[model samples]
Target: MAASRNLPIGFEASVAGGIPILRVIHESTAGDRLRAVHGILNGTANYILTQMESRAIEFDQALQEAQAAGYAEADPSLDIDGFDARDKLCILARMAFGGRLKVSDIPTYGIRQVRAIDIHSAHRLDSTIRLVGSAEQTEAGLEVSVRPWLVGCRSMLAKVEGVNNAVFLLGDKIGMQMFYGRGAGGDATGAAVVSDLIEIARDLAAGQLSAKKVSGFLDSHDVGICPKPRPVSWYLRLTVKDQRGIVARVAEVIAHRDINIDSLEQEPHLPKERLSFVITVEPVSEPIIQRAVGAINAFEFMLEPVLLLRVE
Candidate 1:
Protein backbone atom coordinates (compact mmCIF):
# COMPACT_ATOMS: atom_id res chain seq x y z
CA MET A 1 0.00 0.00 0.00
CA ALA A 2 2.83 2.46 0.79
CA ALA A 3 4.69 1.67 -2.44
CA SER A 4 1.54 2.15 -4.51
CA ARG A 5 1.07 5.67 -3.15
CA ASN A 6 4.63 6.81 -4.02
CA LEU A 7 5.17 5.01 -7.34
CA PRO A 8 3.62 5.56 -10.76
CA ILE A 9 1.94 2.19 -10.37
CA GLY A 10 -1.64 1.76 -11.49
CA PHE A 11 -1.51 -1.77 -10.09
CA GLU A 12 0.34 -3.47 -7.27
CA ALA A 13 0.49 -7.07 -6.21
CA SER A 14 0.57 -8.76 -2.83
CA VAL A 15 0.91 -12.41 -1.87
CA ALA A 16 0.22 -14.42 1.25
CA GLY A 17 2.41 -17.50 1.18
CA GLY A 18 1.89 -18.27 -2.52
CA ILE A 19 -1.83 -17.51 -2.34
CA PRO A 20 -3.20 -14.98 -4.81
CA ILE A 21 -4.83 -11.90 -3.29
CA LEU A 22 -7.06 -9.09 -4.56
CA ARG A 23 -7.92 -5.66 -3.24
CA VAL A 24 -10.47 -3.12 -4.44
CA ILE A 25 -9.40 0.39 -5.39
CA HIS A 26 -11.86 2.42 -3.35
CA GLU A 27 -10.54 5.94 -3.98
CA SER A 28 -11.66 6.30 -7.54
CA THR A 29 -12.18 9.88 -8.69
CA ALA A 30 -13.86 8.78 -11.91
CA GLY A 31 -16.55 11.40 -11.41
CA ASP A 32 -16.51 14.20 -8.80
CA ARG A 33 -14.19 14.83 -5.91
CA LEU A 34 -15.84 13.77 -2.68
CA ARG A 35 -16.30 16.36 0.07
CA ALA A 36 -18.08 14.22 2.63
CA VAL A 37 -19.54 10.77 3.27
CA HIS A 38 -22.33 10.05 5.71
CA GLY A 39 -24.30 6.88 6.14
CA ILE A 40 -26.36 4.58 8.33
CA LEU A 41 -23.67 1.93 8.68
CA ASN A 42 -25.14 -0.35 11.34
CA GLY A 43 -28.40 -1.97 10.33
CA THR A 44 -29.20 -3.34 13.78
CA ALA A 45 -28.87 0.10 15.36
CA ASN A 46 -30.87 1.62 12.56
CA TYR A 47 -33.65 -0.94 12.92
CA ILE A 48 -33.90 -0.43 16.64
CA LEU A 49 -34.00 3.35 16.34
CA THR A 50 -36.52 3.08 13.53
CA GLN A 51 -38.87 1.03 15.68
CA MET A 52 -38.53 3.49 18.50
CA GLU A 53 -39.65 6.31 16.22
CA SER A 54 -42.22 4.52 14.03
CA ARG A 55 -43.91 2.37 16.65
CA ALA A 56 -43.28 4.67 19.64
CA ILE A 57 -41.55 1.84 21.50
CA GLU A 58 -38.82 1.98 24.08
CA PHE A 59 -35.19 1.16 23.32
CA ASP A 60 -35.25 -2.29 24.95
CA GLN A 61 -38.45 -3.30 23.19
CA ALA A 62 -37.14 -2.11 19.85
CA LEU A 63 -33.92 -4.01 20.46
CA GLN A 64 -35.83 -7.21 21.26
CA GLU A 65 -37.87 -6.87 18.08
CA ALA A 66 -34.66 -6.37 16.12
CA GLN A 67 -33.14 -9.49 17.67
CA ALA A 68 -36.28 -11.51 16.86
CA ALA A 69 -36.11 -10.30 13.26
CA GLY A 70 -32.47 -11.42 13.03
CA TYR A 71 -31.29 -7.88 12.53
CA ALA A 72 -29.29 -8.13 15.76
CA GLU A 73 -27.39 -10.91 17.44
CA ALA A 74 -27.99 -12.20 20.98
CA ASP A 75 -24.87 -10.33 22.03
CA PRO A 76 -25.15 -7.05 20.18
CA SER A 77 -22.61 -5.09 22.12
CA LEU A 78 -20.61 -3.82 19.14
CA ASP A 79 -23.62 -2.33 17.42
CA ILE A 80 -25.44 -1.10 20.51
CA ASP A 81 -22.30 0.34 22.12
CA GLY A 82 -21.28 2.23 18.93
CA PHE A 83 -18.02 0.36 18.30
CA ASP A 84 -19.20 -1.20 15.05
CA ALA A 85 -20.13 2.16 13.61
CA ARG A 86 -16.93 3.66 14.93
CA ASP A 87 -14.90 1.09 13.02
CA LYS A 88 -16.85 1.80 9.86
CA LEU A 89 -16.34 5.54 10.29
CA CYS A 90 -12.59 5.06 10.61
CA ILE A 91 -12.45 3.32 7.25
CA LEU A 92 -14.76 5.82 5.62
CA ALA A 93 -12.78 8.76 6.96
CA ARG A 94 -9.53 7.29 5.69
CA MET A 95 -11.02 6.79 2.26
CA ALA A 96 -12.74 10.14 2.11
CA PHE A 97 -10.08 12.36 3.66
CA GLY A 98 -6.87 10.30 3.23
CA GLY A 99 -5.62 10.36 6.81
CA ARG A 100 -4.55 7.96 9.51
CA LEU A 101 -7.25 7.21 12.06
CA LYS A 102 -8.16 4.63 14.67
CA VAL A 103 -11.44 3.49 16.19
CA SER A 104 -10.55 5.30 19.41
CA ASP A 105 -9.82 8.57 17.59
CA ILE A 106 -13.43 9.40 16.90
CA PRO A 107 -16.02 10.37 19.51
CA THR A 108 -18.87 7.89 19.60
CA TYR A 109 -22.27 7.78 21.31
CA GLY A 110 -24.70 4.90 21.04
CA ILE A 111 -28.48 4.47 21.17
CA ARG A 112 -28.57 2.47 24.39
CA GLN A 113 -29.76 5.49 26.38
CA VAL A 114 -32.46 6.54 23.93
CA ARG A 115 -35.97 6.33 25.36
CA ALA A 116 -39.53 6.49 24.04
CA ILE A 117 -39.84 9.99 25.46
CA ASP A 118 -36.88 11.13 23.38
CA ILE A 119 -38.52 9.77 20.28
CA HIS A 120 -41.81 11.40 21.23
CA SER A 121 -40.01 14.66 21.78
CA ALA A 122 -38.43 14.35 18.37
CA HIS A 123 -41.87 13.87 16.83
CA ARG A 124 -43.13 16.98 18.55
CA LEU A 125 -40.27 18.91 16.96
CA ASP A 126 -41.09 17.48 13.53
CA SER A 127 -38.03 15.29 13.53
CA THR A 128 -36.76 11.74 14.18
CA ILE A 129 -33.56 10.09 15.33
CA ARG A 130 -31.08 8.00 13.34
CA LEU A 131 -27.65 6.56 14.02
CA VAL A 132 -25.43 8.45 11.59
CA GLY A 133 -21.79 7.77 10.75
CA SER A 134 -20.31 10.83 9.12
CA ALA A 135 -16.90 12.09 7.93
CA GLU A 136 -16.37 15.50 6.44
CA GLN A 137 -13.33 17.48 5.44
CA THR A 138 -13.45 20.71 7.40
CA GLU A 139 -11.08 23.52 8.24
CA ALA A 140 -10.60 22.00 11.69
CA GLY A 141 -9.59 18.74 9.96
CA LEU A 142 -11.64 15.63 9.29
CA GLU A 143 -14.81 15.97 11.36
CA VAL A 144 -15.97 12.44 12.07
CA SER A 145 -18.28 10.76 14.57
CA VAL A 146 -20.71 7.88 14.91
CA ARG A 147 -23.80 8.78 16.92
CA PRO A 148 -27.55 9.26 16.93
CA TRP A 149 -28.72 12.63 15.52
CA LEU A 150 -32.10 14.23 15.36
CA VAL A 151 -32.89 14.54 11.66
CA GLY A 152 -35.76 16.59 10.36
CA CYS A 153 -38.77 14.68 9.06
CA ARG A 154 -38.25 15.86 5.48
CA SER A 155 -34.55 15.10 5.39
CA MET A 156 -33.21 12.20 3.36
CA LEU A 157 -31.55 10.67 6.39
CA ALA A 158 -34.86 10.49 8.20
CA LYS A 159 -36.42 8.76 5.18
CA VAL A 160 -34.19 5.73 5.76
CA GLU A 161 -36.09 3.38 8.08
CA GLY A 162 -36.00 -0.18 9.41
CA VAL A 163 -33.10 -2.31 8.12
CA ASN A 164 -32.52 -0.24 5.05
CA ASN A 165 -29.29 1.72 4.58
CA ALA A 166 -28.55 5.00 2.90
CA VAL A 167 -25.18 6.58 2.18
CA PHE A 168 -25.03 10.24 1.27
CA LEU A 169 -21.95 11.48 -0.47
CA LEU A 170 -21.34 15.15 -1.13
CA GLY A 171 -18.97 16.31 -3.86
CA ASP A 172 -17.79 19.67 -5.02
CA LYS A 173 -19.17 19.05 -8.49
CA ILE A 174 -21.99 16.61 -7.97
CA GLY A 175 -23.50 18.43 -4.99
CA MET A 176 -25.21 15.72 -2.93
CA GLN A 177 -25.90 12.15 -4.01
CA MET A 178 -27.45 9.32 -2.04
CA PHE A 179 -27.20 5.57 -2.43
CA TYR A 180 -29.98 3.67 -0.69
CA GLY A 181 -30.66 -0.07 -0.30
CA ARG A 182 -31.05 -2.92 2.12
CA GLY A 183 -28.28 -2.66 4.71
CA ALA A 184 -28.25 -6.13 6.26
CA GLY A 185 -29.03 -9.83 5.90
CA GLY A 186 -26.73 -12.46 4.39
CA ASP A 187 -28.34 -12.02 1.02
CA ALA A 188 -27.38 -8.34 0.83
CA THR A 189 -23.82 -8.92 1.99
CA GLY A 190 -23.46 -11.93 -0.25
CA ALA A 191 -24.71 -9.96 -3.20
CA ALA A 192 -22.00 -7.33 -2.69
CA VAL A 193 -19.29 -9.99 -2.41
CA VAL A 194 -20.58 -11.77 -5.47
CA SER A 195 -20.66 -8.56 -7.44
CA ASP A 196 -16.99 -7.92 -6.71
CA LEU A 197 -16.09 -11.52 -7.52
CA ILE A 198 -17.92 -11.37 -10.83
CA GLU A 199 -16.09 -8.20 -11.77
CA ILE A 200 -12.75 -9.80 -11.00
CA ALA A 201 -13.76 -12.89 -12.97
CA ARG A 202 -14.59 -10.74 -15.99
CA ASP A 203 -11.19 -9.01 -15.74
CA LEU A 204 -9.44 -12.38 -15.59
CA ALA A 205 -11.39 -13.67 -18.59
CA ALA A 206 -10.38 -10.61 -20.58
CA GLY A 207 -6.71 -11.09 -19.66
CA GLN A 208 -6.88 -7.81 -17.73
CA LEU A 209 -6.44 -9.23 -14.23
CA SER A 210 -4.08 -6.93 -12.38
CA ALA A 211 -3.65 -5.42 -8.96
CA LYS A 212 -5.31 -2.00 -8.78
CA LYS A 213 -3.54 0.05 -6.19
CA VAL A 214 -5.76 2.24 -4.06
CA SER A 215 -4.68 5.50 -2.46
CA GLY A 216 -5.67 7.08 0.91
CA PHE A 217 -5.10 3.93 3.01
CA LEU A 218 -1.32 4.40 3.09
CA ASP A 219 -1.36 8.06 4.21
CA SER A 220 0.33 8.11 7.62
CA HIS A 221 -0.44 11.72 8.47
CA ASP A 222 -2.33 11.95 11.70
CA VAL A 223 -5.88 13.22 11.24
CA GLY A 224 -6.01 16.18 13.59
CA ILE A 225 -9.60 16.16 14.85
CA CYS A 226 -9.93 19.59 16.40
CA PRO A 227 -13.30 19.97 18.05
CA LYS A 228 -15.25 22.45 15.91
CA PRO A 229 -17.76 23.80 18.37
CA ARG A 230 -20.64 25.06 16.27
CA PRO A 231 -23.68 26.49 17.94
CA VAL A 232 -26.77 24.34 17.42
CA SER A 233 -30.07 23.50 19.08
CA TRP A 234 -30.04 20.64 21.58
CA TYR A 235 -32.56 18.32 23.23
CA LEU A 236 -31.94 17.33 26.82
CA ARG A 237 -34.02 14.96 28.92
CA LEU A 238 -33.64 14.60 32.66
CA THR A 239 -35.27 11.90 34.76
CA VAL A 240 -35.65 13.10 38.30
CA LYS A 241 -36.95 12.15 41.72
CA ASP A 242 -39.49 14.95 41.48
CA GLN A 243 -38.83 17.69 43.99
CA ARG A 244 -39.45 21.39 44.46
CA GLY A 245 -37.25 23.87 42.59
CA ILE A 246 -36.08 21.15 40.20
CA VAL A 247 -36.71 23.34 37.20
CA ALA A 248 -35.30 26.43 38.90
CA ARG A 249 -32.16 24.58 39.91
CA VAL A 250 -31.61 23.21 36.42
CA ALA A 251 -32.30 26.60 34.89
CA GLU A 252 -29.70 28.15 37.16
CA VAL A 253 -27.09 25.79 35.81
CA ILE A 254 -28.06 26.62 32.25
CA ALA A 255 -27.88 30.32 33.06
CA HIS A 256 -24.46 29.90 34.59
CA ARG A 257 -23.27 28.37 31.33
CA ASP A 258 -24.73 31.34 29.43
CA ILE A 259 -27.07 29.04 27.52
CA ASN A 260 -30.65 30.05 26.90
CA ILE A 261 -33.49 27.59 27.27
CA ASP A 262 -35.99 27.62 24.45
CA SER A 263 -38.63 25.51 26.14
CA LEU A 264 -39.25 23.18 29.06
CA GLU A 265 -41.79 20.37 29.13
CA GLN A 266 -42.75 17.61 31.55
CA GLU A 267 -44.25 14.32 30.54
CA PRO A 268 -47.75 14.35 31.91
CA HIS A 269 -49.55 11.54 33.78
CA LEU A 270 -46.33 10.23 35.28
CA PRO A 271 -45.80 9.52 38.98
CA LYS A 272 -44.52 12.44 41.01
CA GLU A 273 -41.83 10.25 42.49
CA ARG A 274 -40.25 9.68 39.06
CA LEU A 275 -40.78 12.30 36.41
CA SER A 276 -39.07 13.26 33.16
CA PHE A 277 -38.21 16.82 32.23
CA VAL A 278 -37.46 17.73 28.63
CA ILE A 279 -35.65 20.93 27.77
CA THR A 280 -34.85 22.48 24.43
CA VAL A 281 -32.14 25.05 24.38
CA GLU A 282 -31.23 27.77 21.92
CA PRO A 283 -28.06 27.41 19.92
CA VAL A 284 -25.16 26.62 22.24
CA SER A 285 -21.80 24.91 21.98
CA GLU A 286 -21.51 21.31 23.15
CA PRO A 287 -19.05 22.27 25.89
CA ILE A 288 -21.51 24.72 27.38
CA ILE A 289 -24.26 22.15 27.42
CA GLN A 290 -22.00 19.51 28.91
CA ARG A 291 -21.05 21.84 31.75
CA ALA A 292 -24.67 22.61 32.49
CA VAL A 293 -25.64 18.96 32.31
CA GLY A 294 -22.82 18.02 34.64
CA ALA A 295 -23.97 20.51 37.23
CA ILE A 296 -27.62 19.42 36.91
CA ASN A 297 -26.79 15.72 37.24
CA ALA A 298 -24.94 16.43 40.48
CA PHE A 299 -28.22 17.37 42.09
CA GLU A 300 -29.69 14.86 44.54
CA PHE A 301 -33.08 14.92 42.83
CA MET A 302 -31.71 13.32 39.69
CA LEU A 303 -32.82 9.74 39.13
CA GLU A 304 -30.81 9.09 35.97
CA PRO A 305 -28.24 10.73 33.79
CA VAL A 306 -29.43 13.30 31.30
CA LEU A 307 -29.88 12.29 27.66
CA LEU A 308 -28.59 14.79 25.10
CA LEU A 309 -29.28 14.83 21.36
CA ARG A 310 -28.24 17.28 18.67
CA VAL A 311 -31.06 18.87 16.74
CA GLU A 312 -30.21 18.81 13.07
Candidate 2:
Protein backbone atom coordinates (compact mmCIF):
# COMPACT_ATOMS: atom_id res chain seq x y z
CA MET A 1 0.00 0.00 0.00
CA ALA A 2 2.94 2.34 0.68
CA ALA A 3 4.02 1.87 -2.97
CA SER A 4 0.76 3.67 -3.78
CA ARG A 5 -0.70 6.70 -1.88
CA ASN A 6 -1.18 5.41 1.70
CA LEU A 7 -1.42 6.76 5.27
CA PRO A 8 -1.67 3.65 7.41
CA ILE A 9 -1.54 4.37 11.17
CA GLY A 10 -2.11 2.60 14.51
CA PHE A 11 0.49 1.24 16.97
CA GLU A 12 1.27 -2.39 17.67
CA ALA A 13 -0.07 -3.94 20.90
CA SER A 14 -0.81 -1.86 23.98
CA VAL A 15 1.81 0.83 24.65
CA ALA A 16 2.18 -1.30 27.77
CA GLY A 17 2.04 -5.09 27.97
CA GLY A 18 -1.15 -7.14 28.36
CA ILE A 19 -3.85 -4.47 28.15
CA PRO A 20 -6.37 -5.71 25.63
CA ILE A 21 -7.02 -2.48 23.76
CA LEU A 22 -6.90 -0.72 20.39
CA ARG A 23 -7.83 2.58 18.72
CA VAL A 24 -9.92 2.30 15.53
CA ILE A 25 -9.89 5.33 13.26
CA HIS A 26 -11.46 6.46 10.00
CA GLU A 27 -12.36 9.55 7.98
CA SER A 28 -15.00 11.43 9.97
CA THR A 29 -18.11 12.90 8.36
CA ALA A 30 -19.64 16.12 9.81
CA GLY A 31 -20.30 14.32 13.07
CA ASP A 32 -18.82 13.93 16.58
CA ARG A 33 -15.60 11.92 16.78
CA LEU A 34 -15.42 8.35 18.08
CA ARG A 35 -12.61 6.18 19.55
CA ALA A 36 -12.13 2.68 20.94
CA VAL A 37 -9.71 1.93 23.82
CA HIS A 38 -8.89 -0.76 26.37
CA GLY A 39 -7.16 -0.50 29.78
CA ILE A 40 -5.84 -2.49 32.81
CA LEU A 41 -2.42 -3.11 31.30
CA ASN A 42 -0.97 -5.12 34.17
CA GLY A 43 -2.09 -8.51 35.38
CA THR A 44 0.43 -8.72 38.24
CA ALA A 45 -1.27 -6.13 40.41
CA ASN A 46 -4.69 -7.43 39.49
CA TYR A 47 -3.73 -10.96 40.39
CA ILE A 48 -2.17 -9.79 43.63
CA LEU A 49 -5.29 -7.90 44.63
CA THR A 50 -7.39 -10.92 43.78
CA GLN A 51 -5.28 -13.36 45.76
CA MET A 52 -5.06 -10.98 48.68
CA GLU A 53 -8.84 -10.85 48.84
CA SER A 54 -9.09 -14.64 48.97
CA ARG A 55 -6.11 -15.16 51.31
CA ALA A 56 -6.97 -12.16 53.48
CA ILE A 57 -3.32 -11.12 53.45
CA GLU A 58 -1.96 -7.66 53.97
CA PHE A 59 -1.03 -5.53 50.97
CA ASP A 60 2.72 -5.72 51.46
CA GLN A 61 2.62 -9.46 52.03
CA ALA A 62 0.40 -10.07 49.05
CA LEU A 63 2.70 -8.05 46.79
CA GLN A 64 5.68 -9.99 47.99
CA GLU A 65 3.89 -13.23 47.34
CA ALA A 66 3.00 -12.11 43.87
CA GLN A 67 6.62 -11.30 43.09
CA ALA A 68 7.54 -14.77 44.29
CA ALA A 69 4.81 -16.32 42.17
CA GLY A 70 6.37 -14.67 39.09
CA TYR A 71 3.12 -12.89 38.36
CA ALA A 72 4.79 -9.57 39.16
CA GLU A 73 7.92 -8.31 37.44
CA ALA A 74 11.21 -7.68 39.25
CA ASP A 75 10.47 -3.97 39.27
CA PRO A 76 6.69 -3.74 39.29
CA SER A 77 6.61 0.03 39.76
CA LEU A 78 4.98 0.85 36.42
CA ASP A 79 2.07 -1.53 36.94
CA ILE A 80 1.37 -0.55 40.55
CA ASP A 81 2.09 3.18 40.23
CA GLY A 82 -0.71 3.88 37.72
CA PHE A 83 1.80 4.87 35.02
CA ASP A 84 0.63 2.02 32.81
CA ALA A 85 -2.96 3.18 33.12
CA ARG A 86 -1.90 6.70 32.16
CA ASP A 87 -0.30 5.43 28.95
CA LYS A 88 -3.49 3.64 28.01
CA LEU A 89 -5.50 6.78 28.76
CA CYS A 90 -3.18 8.85 26.61
CA ILE A 91 -3.78 6.57 23.65
CA LEU A 92 -7.52 6.82 24.18
CA ALA A 93 -7.38 10.59 24.62
CA ARG A 94 -5.26 11.12 21.53
CA MET A 95 -7.72 9.08 19.49
CA ALA A 96 -10.73 10.87 20.99
CA PHE A 97 -9.55 14.47 20.65
CA GLY A 98 -6.91 14.05 17.92
CA GLY A 99 -3.63 15.33 19.39
CA ARG A 100 -0.58 14.36 21.34
CA LEU A 101 -0.44 14.12 25.14
CA LYS A 102 2.51 14.00 27.50
CA VAL A 103 2.14 11.06 29.83
CA SER A 104 3.87 13.01 32.60
CA ASP A 105 1.21 15.73 32.38
CA ILE A 106 -1.40 13.35 33.77
CA PRO A 107 -1.75 12.70 37.51
CA THR A 108 -1.77 9.08 38.58
CA TYR A 109 -2.17 7.07 41.80
CA GLY A 110 -1.48 3.38 42.26
CA ILE A 111 -3.04 0.71 44.49
CA ARG A 112 0.24 0.28 46.41
CA GLN A 113 -1.11 2.74 48.96
CA VAL A 114 -4.28 0.71 49.40
CA ARG A 115 -4.36 -1.35 52.56
CA ALA A 116 -6.15 -4.47 53.77
CA ILE A 117 -7.99 -2.20 56.17
CA ASP A 118 -9.19 -0.27 53.13
CA ILE A 119 -10.62 -3.42 51.59
CA HIS A 120 -12.35 -4.31 54.84
CA SER A 121 -13.72 -0.80 55.31
CA ALA A 122 -15.03 -0.70 51.74
CA HIS A 123 -16.76 -3.97 52.47
CA ARG A 124 -18.34 -2.38 55.52
CA LEU A 125 -19.78 0.30 53.25
CA ASP A 126 -20.79 -2.11 50.45
CA SER A 127 -18.26 -0.76 47.99
CA THR A 128 -15.00 -1.82 46.34
CA ILE A 129 -11.76 -0.46 44.91
CA ARG A 130 -11.49 0.33 41.20
CA LEU A 131 -8.70 1.90 39.17
CA VAL A 132 -10.42 4.61 37.10
CA GLY A 133 -8.69 6.29 34.15
CA SER A 134 -10.82 8.99 32.64
CA ALA A 135 -10.55 11.89 30.21
CA GLU A 136 -13.52 14.22 29.99
CA GLN A 137 -14.10 17.55 28.31
CA THR A 138 -13.61 20.39 30.80
CA GLU A 139 -13.85 24.13 30.44
CA ALA A 140 -10.11 23.79 30.59
CA GLY A 141 -8.71 21.23 28.09
CA LEU A 142 -9.71 17.67 29.06
CA GLU A 143 -9.70 16.83 32.78
CA VAL A 144 -7.98 13.50 33.19
CA SER A 145 -6.75 11.27 36.02
CA VAL A 146 -6.00 7.63 36.76
CA ARG A 147 -6.54 6.60 40.35
CA PRO A 148 -8.35 4.25 42.67
CA TRP A 149 -11.86 5.59 43.18
CA LEU A 150 -14.58 4.45 45.53
CA VAL A 151 -17.55 3.36 43.44
CA GLY A 152 -21.00 2.30 44.60
CA CYS A 153 -22.28 -1.19 43.85
CA ARG A 154 -25.23 0.08 41.87
CA SER A 155 -23.01 2.10 39.52
CA MET A 156 -22.16 0.33 36.27
CA LEU A 157 -18.63 1.66 36.56
CA ALA A 158 -18.16 -0.35 39.74
CA LYS A 159 -18.67 -3.59 37.86
CA VAL A 160 -15.17 -3.25 36.26
CA GLU A 161 -12.69 -4.95 38.51
CA GLY A 162 -9.58 -7.17 38.65
CA VAL A 163 -8.01 -7.46 35.20
CA ASN A 164 -10.90 -6.09 33.18
CA ASN A 165 -10.74 -2.78 31.28
CA ALA A 166 -13.49 -0.47 30.02
CA VAL A 167 -13.81 2.63 27.84
CA PHE A 168 -16.35 5.44 27.49
CA LEU A 169 -17.06 7.67 24.48
CA LEU A 170 -19.13 10.86 24.39
CA GLY A 171 -20.39 12.73 21.36
CA ASP A 172 -22.78 15.61 20.68
CA LYS A 173 -25.21 13.23 19.02
CA ILE A 174 -24.14 9.79 20.22
CA GLY A 175 -24.36 10.59 23.97
CA MET A 176 -22.48 8.05 26.16
CA GLN A 177 -21.40 4.48 25.48
CA MET A 178 -19.09 2.20 27.52
CA PHE A 179 -17.03 -0.77 26.27
CA TYR A 180 -15.79 -3.51 28.62
CA GLY A 181 -13.91 -6.82 28.43
CA ARG A 182 -10.88 -8.71 29.67
CA GLY A 183 -8.19 -6.05 29.83
CA ALA A 184 -5.06 -8.16 30.17
CA GLY A 185 -3.23 -11.12 28.62
CA GLY A 186 -1.11 -11.26 25.43
CA ASP A 187 -3.64 -12.92 23.16
CA ALA A 188 -6.46 -10.52 23.90
CA THR A 189 -4.32 -7.41 23.52
CA GLY A 190 -2.64 -8.74 20.37
CA ALA A 191 -6.02 -9.24 18.78
CA ALA A 192 -6.89 -5.59 19.49
CA VAL A 193 -3.64 -4.40 17.93
CA VAL A 194 -4.32 -6.36 14.79
CA SER A 195 -7.84 -4.98 14.58
CA ASP A 196 -6.49 -1.43 14.50
CA LEU A 197 -3.76 -2.38 12.02
CA ILE A 198 -6.32 -3.91 9.70
CA GLU A 199 -8.48 -0.76 9.73
CA ILE A 200 -5.52 1.54 9.18
CA ALA A 201 -4.36 -0.60 6.26
CA ARG A 202 -7.79 -0.49 4.67
CA ASP A 203 -8.02 3.29 5.13
CA LEU A 204 -4.52 3.76 3.69
CA ALA A 205 -5.53 1.67 0.71
CA ALA A 206 -8.70 3.72 0.20
CA GLY A 207 -7.00 7.14 -0.08
CA GLN A 208 -5.81 10.18 1.88
CA LEU A 209 -8.10 11.09 4.79
CA SER A 210 -9.03 14.47 6.33
CA ALA A 211 -7.84 15.55 9.81
CA LYS A 212 -11.03 16.85 11.53
CA LYS A 213 -11.65 13.83 13.78
CA VAL A 214 -8.00 12.86 13.64
CA SER A 215 -6.88 16.22 14.98
CA GLY A 216 -9.53 17.02 17.61
CA PHE A 217 -7.03 16.36 20.38
CA LEU A 218 -4.71 19.07 19.02
CA ASP A 219 -7.28 21.57 20.32
CA SER A 220 -6.05 22.15 23.85
CA HIS A 221 -8.55 22.45 26.70
CA ASP A 222 -7.60 23.11 30.30
CA VAL A 223 -7.38 19.95 32.43
CA GLY A 224 -9.60 20.39 35.45
CA ILE A 225 -9.25 18.29 38.60
CA CYS A 226 -12.45 18.02 40.57
CA PRO A 227 -12.24 19.94 43.82
CA LYS A 228 -14.96 20.25 46.46
CA PRO A 229 -16.34 17.03 45.10
CA ARG A 230 -19.64 15.57 46.32
CA PRO A 231 -19.99 14.43 49.91
CA VAL A 232 -19.51 10.76 50.77
CA SER A 233 -18.87 8.69 53.88
CA TRP A 234 -15.26 7.75 54.72
CA TYR A 235 -13.27 5.11 56.65
CA LEU A 236 -10.21 5.69 58.83
CA ARG A 237 -8.10 2.82 60.11
CA LEU A 238 -5.34 3.54 62.62
CA THR A 239 -2.74 0.86 63.16
CA VAL A 240 -0.79 0.66 66.44
CA LYS A 241 1.20 -1.87 68.39
CA ASP A 242 -1.21 -2.45 71.26
CA GLN A 243 -0.95 0.24 73.92
CA ARG A 244 -3.17 2.10 76.38
CA GLY A 245 -4.58 5.61 75.80
CA ILE A 246 -4.92 4.69 72.09
CA VAL A 247 -8.68 5.10 72.06
CA ALA A 248 -8.67 8.35 74.04
CA ARG A 249 -5.94 9.77 71.83
CA VAL A 250 -7.73 8.74 68.68
CA ALA A 251 -11.05 10.13 69.97
CA GLU A 252 -9.56 13.50 70.80
CA VAL A 253 -8.29 13.92 67.22
CA ILE A 254 -11.63 12.91 65.75
CA ALA A 255 -13.47 15.28 68.09
CA HIS A 256 -11.15 18.22 67.42
CA ARG A 257 -12.09 18.01 63.76
CA ASP A 258 -15.86 18.02 64.58
CA ILE A 259 -16.16 14.76 62.65
CA ASN A 260 -19.08 12.60 63.67
CA ILE A 261 -18.30 8.92 63.91
CA ASP A 262 -21.22 6.92 62.55
CA SER A 263 -19.62 3.62 63.51
CA LEU A 264 -16.45 2.49 65.31
CA GLU A 265 -15.02 -0.96 65.72
CA GLN A 266 -11.77 -2.45 66.97
CA GLU A 267 -10.63 -4.84 64.28
CA PRO A 268 -10.89 -8.44 65.42
CA HIS A 269 -7.77 -10.68 65.40
CA LEU A 270 -5.37 -7.80 65.80
CA PRO A 271 -2.88 -8.62 68.51
CA LYS A 272 -2.68 -6.37 71.55
CA GLU A 273 0.80 -5.42 70.39
CA ARG A 274 -0.57 -4.50 66.96
CA LEU A 275 -4.11 -3.23 67.11
CA SER A 276 -6.27 -1.96 64.28
CA PHE A 277 -8.69 0.85 65.15
CA VAL A 278 -11.36 1.38 62.53
CA ILE A 279 -13.82 4.26 62.36
CA THR A 280 -16.44 5.44 59.88
CA VAL A 281 -17.37 9.10 59.56
CA GLU A 282 -20.60 10.51 58.22
CA PRO A 283 -20.75 11.92 54.72
CA VAL A 284 -18.41 14.89 54.27
CA SER A 285 -16.06 16.51 51.81
CA GLU A 286 -12.98 14.44 50.97
CA PRO A 287 -10.59 17.16 52.11
CA ILE A 288 -12.26 17.50 55.52
CA ILE A 289 -12.26 13.78 56.26
CA GLN A 290 -8.70 13.49 55.00
CA ARG A 291 -7.72 16.31 57.37
CA ALA A 292 -9.12 14.39 60.34
CA VAL A 293 -7.42 11.19 59.22
CA GLY A 294 -4.14 13.09 58.90
CA ALA A 295 -4.43 14.58 62.36
CA ILE A 296 -5.26 11.26 64.02
CA ASN A 297 -2.48 9.51 62.13
CA ALA A 298 0.04 11.95 63.60
CA PHE A 299 -0.48 10.58 67.11
CA GLU A 300 2.65 8.85 68.50
CA PHE A 301 0.67 5.71 69.34
CA MET A 302 -0.14 5.11 65.69
CA LEU A 303 2.02 2.29 64.33
CA GLU A 304 1.44 3.42 60.75
CA PRO A 305 -0.48 6.30 59.26
CA VAL A 306 -4.23 6.07 59.23
CA LEU A 307 -5.56 4.27 56.16
CA LEU A 308 -8.34 6.29 54.53
CA LEU A 309 -11.12 5.04 52.23
CA ARG A 310 -14.15 6.65 50.62
CA VAL A 311 -17.29 4.82 51.65
CA GLU A 312 -20.17 4.76 49.22
Using TM-score, give the best candidate's number.
Answer: 1
- lDDT by residue for model 1 over 108-183, one digit each (tens)? 9888999998899888888999888888777766777787888899999999887766667787876886766665
Give the TM-score of each candidate.
0.82, 0.67
Candidate 1 least-lDDT 10 residues = 16-25
- Location of the lowest summed lDDT over 10 successive residues in candidate 2: 1-10
Best by lDDT: 1
| Candidate 2: tens digits of C-alpha lDDT, residues 1-312 | 211212223233334332222333222212555423324444556656655555667888987876776556678786677776676676566556555566687767777877776677666666666666666654435656676665666666666555555565665655665656554434454343223422332343354433322333444653344455455777677788877787887777778877788888887876788888778788886678778777877777788776665553
Q: Give the runs in model 1 whose Cα sits over 4 Å from its true position.
A: 1-33, 192-214
Candidate 1 structure lDDT? 0.72
